[model samples]
Target: MKELICISCPMGCHLQVEGESVENIVVSGNGCVRGIIYAKNEITAPKRMVCGTVKINGATQPVVSVKTKEPIPKEKIFDCLAELNNTTIEAPVSVGDVAIVNVCNTGVDVVVTKGLSKR
Candidate 1:
């Protein structure tokens, strides 16, 4: 059995799950069906959004904020960050610009969350 707190909604339901596989798992203490789904996903294959800053050359600020375009496999996050750490973007980048393409081969782009202009 596994215990978890559902984060899929604002309710924050405490959930208890039993069974070895998703097919046979039983969930209790969920206020809504979303909690069941959240538990299953969290247990089977977890993912997370990556957000951080990378160095930028010639920008007003020395660094720019960036985030993964979509949630990536949790295990790939550090590898993704390592790639981002080695990256340096040119100034004049705009919001929504792609900072790193298919980062860490996860098929997700890292995009600029804040725009910066040349110094």
Candidate 2:
């Protein structure tokens, strides 16, 4: 058996996962449906949701926080971040504006977290 702390919810369930069969995997203290799914995946293949900054044009700040519209494969996160770091966008950026599209071929776009106004 392997122990895991569920990060999907604030409750952070203490769980035990083992074996390939779902019936053989013993889970305890999960707070919600999402936690169950999270724990199952975490045991098989852990993943993450990443958020970071990207350069913004004509804004008071040099950059803005951008995140994928949907979670991408964890392996591509660094490459996505690096790609975003290398790119810049014009100002008047909406809060949900797409800063980088099709990042790392994960079929996800990094979007602005907040509005960026023109100088």
Candidate 3:
């Protein structure tokens, strides 16, 4: 059996999953559509959120916040981080700039969340 927490809302729904085809799912705490999506993804192909700091050249803090626009394959999370950690970018970054493209080959890109200018 597999367990997953629904991040759809404040009421985190706990889902219990079983079976090979993932049809024998038993969920009791789902509160809405978002929860259903979470459960389905959890049983079949679980994904992970990527959010961390990327080094920023000439910055006061030397790092800028970044996150994947979409959930990436959980299995490739480590690989994604490996690439991200190895990357370095200059400041003057826009909020929607693609910080890391083709992350883990999961067709998801990590991007900067806030603009960072050289100071």
Q: Compare the candidates by lDDT and give the number of the best one.
A: 1
Which regions of candidate 2 are displaced past 4 Å?
Answer: 21-25
Q: Note the residue pairs that clash in candidate 1.
A: none
Instruction: Quote model 2's TM-score.
Output: 0.88
lDDT of 1: 0.92
Clashing pairs in 2: none
Q: What local lDDT does model 1 show for residue 66?
A: 99
Q: Once superposed on the true structure, which residue ranges of model 3 sit more than 4 Å away at CA? A: 1-3, 16-26
Model 3 per-residue lDDT tens digits across residues 1-119: 66678876678777665553547666656677777677877778888888887888976668888998998888988888888898888888989799888887889988988898788
Please report how far candidate 2 places residue 92 from its true position, in Å.
Answer: 0.7
lDDT of 1 by residue, 1-119 (tens): 89999987788999999876789889999999988887887888877899999999999899999999998999999999999999999999999999999999999999999989889
For all candidates in order, the CA lDDT equals 0.92, 0.79, 0.80
Error of 3 at 9 (Å): 2.8
Lowest lDDT 10-residue stretch of candidate 1:
38-47
Q: State the displacement of the C-alpha of residue 106, model 2, in Å, after optimal TM-score superposition.
A: 0.7
Model 3 RMSD in Å is 2.1
Candidate 2 lDDT over 81-117, as tens digits, reads 7998898998888889888888888887788898978
- Models ranked on lDDT: 1, 3, 2
Higher-scoring candidate on TM-score, 1 or 2: 2
Q: What is the model-wide C-alpha lDDT for candidate 2?
A: 0.79
